[model samples]
Target chain A: MLQYVLKRLGIAILVAVTVSMITFSMIYLSGDPAIALAGETATQEDIQNIRRVYGYDQPIVVQYANWLWNALQGDFGQSHYLKKPVADVIFERLPTTMLLGACALIFALVLSIPLGVVAAVRPNSLIDRIALTIAVVGQAMPSFWFALTMMLWLGIYWRLLPISGTASWANFVMPSIALGYYITPAVMRLTRAGMLEVLSSDYIRTARAKGLRPMTVLFKHALRNAIIPVVSLAAVQFGFMLGGSIVIETIFAVNGLGFLAWESIQRADLPMMQAIVLVLSFFYIILTFLADMLNAWLDPRIRVM
Target chain B: MAERVLEVEDLCVEIPIPSGMLRPVQHVSFHVGQGETLAIVGESGCGKSLTSLAIMDLLPSKAKRRAERLVLDGDALTGMTERQMADIRGNQMSMIFQEPMTSLNPAYTIGNQLTEAMLRHKSVSLAEAKDRAVWLLEKVGITAARSRLGQYPHQLSGGLRQRVMIAMALMCGPDMIIADEPTTALDVTIQAQILHLLAELQDEFHMGMILITHDLGVVARVADRVAVMYAGQFVETGTAAQIFDSPTHPYTQGLLECIPIPGKTERGAHLGSIPGIVPSLVGEIRGCHFAGRCPYVHEACTAEDVSLRPSLDAGHEYRCVLSPQAAIANRNKQAAQ
Candidate 1:
């Protein structure tokens, strides 16, 4: 088990390094960073001075090494627009995004797992149709549109929520719903399909033949096996929620890393963009690693392998 | 006779599909006494497994199981609610399935699956259940039983897992066990061992067993009574000796002839075979279900339904148009020709 975990961790580190390298290359890929940093009116000499000051004149290998060394120490350089340390700006906004991501995931699982199980338990029944309709609507409607509708009704009309700030937990209700509901369809469908398959398995027959309570058979035996793949899906969705929160953050003024990313892109703050992309990519890799571990723990077949 | 552990009468299972209502098990009835093994032998899709599942009240949701009476030790299972049936299941009666590789939950440890039934039905503590699990596992011939408890299903081989399944079925100490093709998925060598273990355990526990299988050899070796089923009905049923020695029904006789008789059958000669496939049970099924395949099939055979009729021997019966004497004379005439 320990060796499996160590191996997963090694792969995770390899992925993070590749992501970091890609994030670092984004600056070069977008043409000269010095030219982008300097004003359009600036002469060649001005561009050269900017390049020298930022050490862009050095070979690409040395430049990458220096940036990687500093990034290793959490020194992500300064934001060109805000004139603040990139890491500070990113870390400051990270908590809200993380909290939002966690809540969104919780809401998605809490709402969809039972729905999926119920739908699967009695397929083609009324409740199953209702759940399927909800899933279809959730999948069809765009998140931004859903967010706007919620903001209009809950924030403007009903005065039920504070829709545009991260002052309290209540502020996240609309955004989380919009973000979480978007992926609920996939998660719920996977769960329903999985449960349907697992519920028909010989083990479930054995479980029923054992005279286990319906709840025990459904939750303990059937769900435990069915939820394995869903766990990995949920992890991937969580990573997606974190990265895709840019639109929601923009609309609600949550001021998370997503909003920071939008601002940096617009203002040509390459350092902040690099840090945000790298950080989010790292989160994605780490989440996938944890999911692998969790799956291995849940299913012994994977553990022995 | 020993005390009757189970009495099922006129049990029918019908499944409705897009085409029509499919009657897979038609008015099948049998009883099993304490410590007796009544093996229901048939080809695949002959509704043998469905009969066992119907008795256990575990049919698919859409499939309707109707029975005149399903009594387990004086308890009427037909009218019991699902909750009441659940209480009786795995307590008064339990089942063992064919595929041990898939019968045990992969995510759970052998210990959890073994003890869960006992824990649910009895008021015993977890420790007590665990102890019973260990004892049962060892009784089923699994060595290092205590260590085997913590291991998951995939950790064990097919044979070992089947032993665990047998141990699990015995955990609650039910009076009746319905083993549906229990050794069908086992290795050839392992098949004998599993059968031996089951026989030993049944003897020790004195539980009435309904052994469902397609293996005539298994039925001959272990079954006290045997029911030969065709399509959705029992074509013949009697003491094992009667069915094997003097199979009166054309279907039963044909089945026995298919098996090679060691030195009796020529080494390179053609083996016996019953011509034609089983008829579909959809819509209305007239006459004997095996009429198409029976060598003596006549015009009248397909004109009406065939029901089980008694032979000269007590408790022996077969479903055929001809009388026992006539059927035997006809077989002898054919053999002489």
Candidate 2:
């Protein structure tokens, strides 16, 4: 087990390094970085001076090495627009994004697992049909449109929730629903399919013949095997939630890393954009790694190798 | 005679398809006594497995089971609620299924699944359940039973897994066991070993057993009484010796002819076979179900419904229009040729 974990960690580190290299080269891909840093109205001498001061005149490999060295030390240089360290801006807003992502994941799992299990219990029954309809609606409805609908109903008319901001748990209600609902259909459909397959398996029949209570047969015998793949899917979806919260964050005015990304893109803040991409990619890689370990622990067959 | 453990009378199972209601098991009834093995023998798709499943009340949701009487040790099972039935199941009666490769749950340890039925049906502590699991595992002939309990299903071989299944069925010391094709999925050598183990266990526990299989050799060796089923109904039923010596029904005669008797059948010669597929049971079935496939099918055979009639031998019955003596004479004449 220790060896398997170390091997996974090695692969995760490799992916992080590759992502960092890509982020570093993105600024150079769009014409000259000096002109962009110095502004369009700057004279040629000012451009040359900016290039020299920022080490743009150095070899590309040398510049990349220097940037990587500083990034390793948690120093991502200053944001051109905010005139503050890029790392400080990111760290300040990260907690909000993490909180939103975690809550949305919890909500999605809590709602979808039982729905999936019930739907599979009696296929084509009333509750099964209702669950399937919910899954379809959740999949078809766009997140932005759903967000706006919730804001109009809950925030403007009924006045049930504060639609915008990240002040308290109440503030997260509308935004989390909009973000969490987007992935509910995928998780729910997977769980339903898995449960259906497991329910028909010979072991399940043996479990029934053993006269296990309905709940014990369903949850302990059936659901335990059915929930393995769902765990990995949830991990990958949580990573997407963290990175894909840009549109929802902007609409709700929750100043998280996604909002910071939007602001940096509009103002041409290259250093801040690079840092955000690098950080988000790292989170994605780490999450996938954790999912693999968890799956191995749950299923002994996978741990044999 | 030993005390009756399980008794069924006029049991039927119907399933609805697009065409019509499929009566797979029609008016089948039998009884098993303590320390006795009643083998239900038939070809594939002959409702042998359905009979056992119906007794367990584990039929699919769409299928319906109706029985005039289903009693276990004088307790009526027909009118019992599902909760009450569950208490009886795996406690008073248990089941062993075919396909040991998939019968045990892959995610659980042998000890967990083995102890589950005992713990659920009895008010036993966890430690007591574990000890029972170990004892049963050893009883089924597994070496190092204590260490084997910690292993998952995939870690064990198919034969070992089947032994574990047998051990699990005996965990609660039930009065009756319904094993559906228990050794059908095993290798030839392993099949004998498993059967030997099962017979030994039944003798030790004196539990009534309903063994469902399609192999005549298995029935001859293990069964106290044999019921030959064809197309949803029993064509013949008798003691093993009576059925083998004088098979009165044409279908039963055809089945006996299909096997290669040792030192009797010619070497490298074509073995006898019962031609024609089993007719569909989707609609109203008239006369004998095997009329179309029987060689001696006469006009009067298909004129009306055929029911079980007593043969010359006491306690032996077969479904046929021909007299028992006449049927036996025809089979003897055919063998003489």
Candidate 3:
């Protein structure tokens, strides 16, 4: 197990490096950052001075290597527009995104598992038909569109909820729903398929023959086996939630890493953009690693290898 | 004779299909005397397993059952709710399934699975349940029962798993056990060991058992009474000795003849094979269900439906168009030639 963890950590470092290089180079793929930062009216000498100050005048590999080295030490240089440390900008906005993502994941799990089990238990019945209908609608509708629709109906038409701003817990309700709704279908479908497969296994029949109640047969014996596949799926979905929080954050005016990343792009702040990309990529990698470890712990067969 | 422990009368199971309604079991009736081992023998798809499932009230939710009576120790079980049936299962009546590897839950330790029935139906503390589990495991001949409790199902071999299943079934000391092809998935040597274990356990507990299998050799060794099923109905039932000595129904005769013996060969002794497949359950048949496969195939055999009739012996019974004297004469002549 220790060897397994070490091997996974080694792979994680390689992944982090690749992600940092791509994100750092892609920010430069567009027009020159100095022109965008110094404005059109600035003189040629002023632009050159700005470029030299930010180390852009150096070789691309040298600039990248320096930036990566500094990033490893938690120094992300300074933000061009804000004129503050890049790490400060990211730190100021991380909590809101983490809260929204966590709530959305919890909501997805709480709603989807029971719905999936009910659907699998009574296939083609009224509850099953309703669950399938909800799954189809959830998958078909995009999160941004769903958020806008919720804003229109719940905020504008009914005046029941706040429309924008992430000031308090109330602000998280609509955006979390929009994000949670989009992810619930995948969880529901996976759980439904997994539970159906387990319900038909020979052990479940033996459990029933042993006189276990139907609910016990379902929740105790069938659900544990069914949950093995769902754990891996949940990990992937959680990573997607973290990275995909951009649209929902923007819609809600929540100042998260996604919103910060968006502002950095408009201003062409290279250090801030690189910082946001690196941090988010790191977050994704860490989450995937944690998920792998959790899955191994939950199922010993995987750990045995 | 001992008092009857279970009486199943005219039990029929109908399953709906796109083609039409299918009757998987039709008017299947039998009884288990206290401490007696009644073996129900038939090939696959002959409703042997279905009969056991029906008795346990563990049939699939889609199946519809109609029975005149299903009594267990004089208690009615025909139309009980699932909860009530559950109360009886594992406590009064338990079952051991065919595939030992799959019968035990893979995720649970052997001790947990063995103690589940005991804890569920009886008011035993966890410690007491554990002790009982170890005791039962040792009774089934599993070595180091205390330590074996911590191991999972995959850790044990096929024979050991079957013993675990038997121990689990007997944990609560159920009055009757329904063992469905208990040793079918094991090797020949393991099969003999399991069969002996089941027989020994049954005698020690004085428990009634209904062993469902298609193997005549198993029935010959373990069964006190035998019931031969064909096309979803019983064609012959009698003492094991009587059925082997003189089988009246053509299906039973065919089944007995199919068992191969080592180092045995006779001229014109074609390995006996039942001639035709079991008929589909969709449509009603006007005549005998086995008429298509019977070697006799008399014109009257196809023209009339035949129900069970008593043989010359007091306890033996069979369902056939031909009288017992004719069947015996036919068997004697075939053996002589």
Candidate 4:
């Protein structure tokens, strides 16, 4: 087990390095950061001075190496758009996005798993049809569009929820719904397929023959076996949710790293953009690694490797 | 005489097909007396498993059943809701299926699977359930039952898993057990052990058992009465001795002849063979469903449908147009030559 943990950690470090390099290189690809930082009205000397001040006058490799070295020491440089430390800007916004992602994940599982199980147990029934319809609709609508529509119906029309901004726990309701709706279909479909397969297995028949109630057979026996695949899918989905909150956060005007990243991109704030990209990428990698470990724990066959 | 424990009468199961309708089981009737072992013998798709499922009311909802009566210990089972069926299944009439490897849930420990029925039917605490589970494990011949109870299904071998299934089935002390080809998936040695264990358990518990299998050897070893099925109908049924020694139906004769014994002649030396497969149940049949493959096929055999009638013995019965005396005479003449 120790060896396995170490091996997984080694793989995670390699993944993190690859993500960092890609994010850093992409930020530099726009070229001539000095001109962009100095702005259109600035003289050539001012541009050169700005380049010197930001160390953009150095070689691209040297700049990337220095940026990476500073990042390792917890220095993300100053945000060009926020006019504050990039790390401080990110730290303030991290909680809201985490909360939104966590709530959406919980909602998706709580709704989709039972729906999928019912649908699978009684295929072609009314409940099954309803679940299938929900899955189709959930997959059809984009997150941003869903968020806007929720905002319109609940915020503007009914005045039941805040239209934009994350202020309190209640404020997370609409954004979480949008995020949950987008992800629910994947969970529902995976759960439905997995449940159907497990339901047909011989053990379920054995459980039924054991005089277990249908609910016990389903929830305790069938669902436990069915959930193995769903756990892995849920893990990947959760990781995606953590990283894919950008569009939903932007639409809701939630003060999150995603929103900050969008604002940084608009102003061409290189350091802050690079920092946000690196941080989000790092988050995605970490979550995926955690998901892999969780999956291994859930299924012993996987742990054999 | 043993007391009658289960009686299934006129049980029919119609499955809807895209092209037409199919009756997988039609008016199949059988019963098991207390502590009696009845074997429903048939090749694949002969409705043996369907009959077992119907008795338990475990058939899928798509299957349409029209049974005159299905009584277990004088309790009616027909038309009961799934919840009610759940109450009776493990408590009164439990079942063990073929493929032990797949029959036990892999995610759960043997102890958990074993105690599930006990917890479900009886008001037992966790400690009581666990104790019962360990006891059952030991009863089924698993060593260190307490320790092995924590092991998963996949951790056990096929034979051990089969023993676990038996342990689970008998955990509730059910009055009857429907073992559908219980030994078919195991090796010869394990199969023998399981069959012996079943016989011993049946005696110890005084439980009526219905063993469904295609193996004549299994029927000879365990069955008191045997029902031979063909094309969703009973072709022949009698005491195991009568069915093996004096098979009345042509299909049963052919099936017995097909079994190869030690020191038997080389293959294809006039060895018996049933010429055709069982007919599909899609369309209606005017005459005997087995007439196409019966060596005694005559115009009358295919001209009208045949129903089960008693042979020479009161309990011995078969579904055929031929007289029992004639069949016995013909079989004797063939054996003599």
Report how far off residue B291 is in candidate 3 (Å): 0.5
Q: What is candidate 1's CA lDDT for residue B305? A: 90
Q: Which candidate is the best by DockQ?
A: 1
Model 2 spans > 4 angstroms off = none
Q: What DockQ values do the models have?
A: 0.91, 0.80, 0.62, 0.68
Candidate 3 collision pairs: none
Count clashing pairs, candidate 1.
Answer: 1
Candidate 3 lDDT, B34-146, residue by residue in tens: 88999999999999999999999888888888889999989999779889999899889999999898878787788888888788899999899999999989999999999
Q: What is the lDDT of residue A191 in candidate 1?
A: 94
lDDT of 2 by residue, A4-91 (tens): 8899999999999999999999999998999988887999999999999889999999999999999999999999889999999999
lDDT tens string, model 4, A1-305?
Answer: 46677888899999998888888887658877778778889999999899899887888789878988999988999987768998888888888878888998898999999999999988889999999999998888777777888889899999998878877777899888888878788888888899999998888888888778778888888887778777777777776776677898878888777777778888888888888888877877777677777766665455643
Q: Could you tell me how far off, in angstroms, the CA of residue A151 lies in candidate 3 after the best superposition?
A: 0.9
Residue B192's lDDT in candidate 2:
90
Q: Give me the candidate number with maximum lDDT.
A: 2
**What does candidate 4's lDDT look like per residue over B1-337, in tens digits?**
7989999899999889897888889889888999999999999998999989888877887788889988999988987888888899889899999999899877777887888789889998989989988888888899998999777777889999999999889988999999999999999989999999999999999999999999988999999999999999998999999999899898898888888765765565666678888888986887899987877889988888899999998799999888999988877776566
lDDT digits (tens) for residues A102-143 of candidate 3: 889888999999999999999889999999999999998988
Error of 1 at B240 (Å): 0.5
When sorted by TM-score, best at the front, the candidate numbers are 1, 2, 3, 4
Clashing pairs in 4: none
**Model 1 per-residue lDDT tens digits across residues A163-247:** 8898888999998888889889999999999999999999999999999999999999999899999999999999988988999
* Chain B, candidate 3: TM-score: 0.97
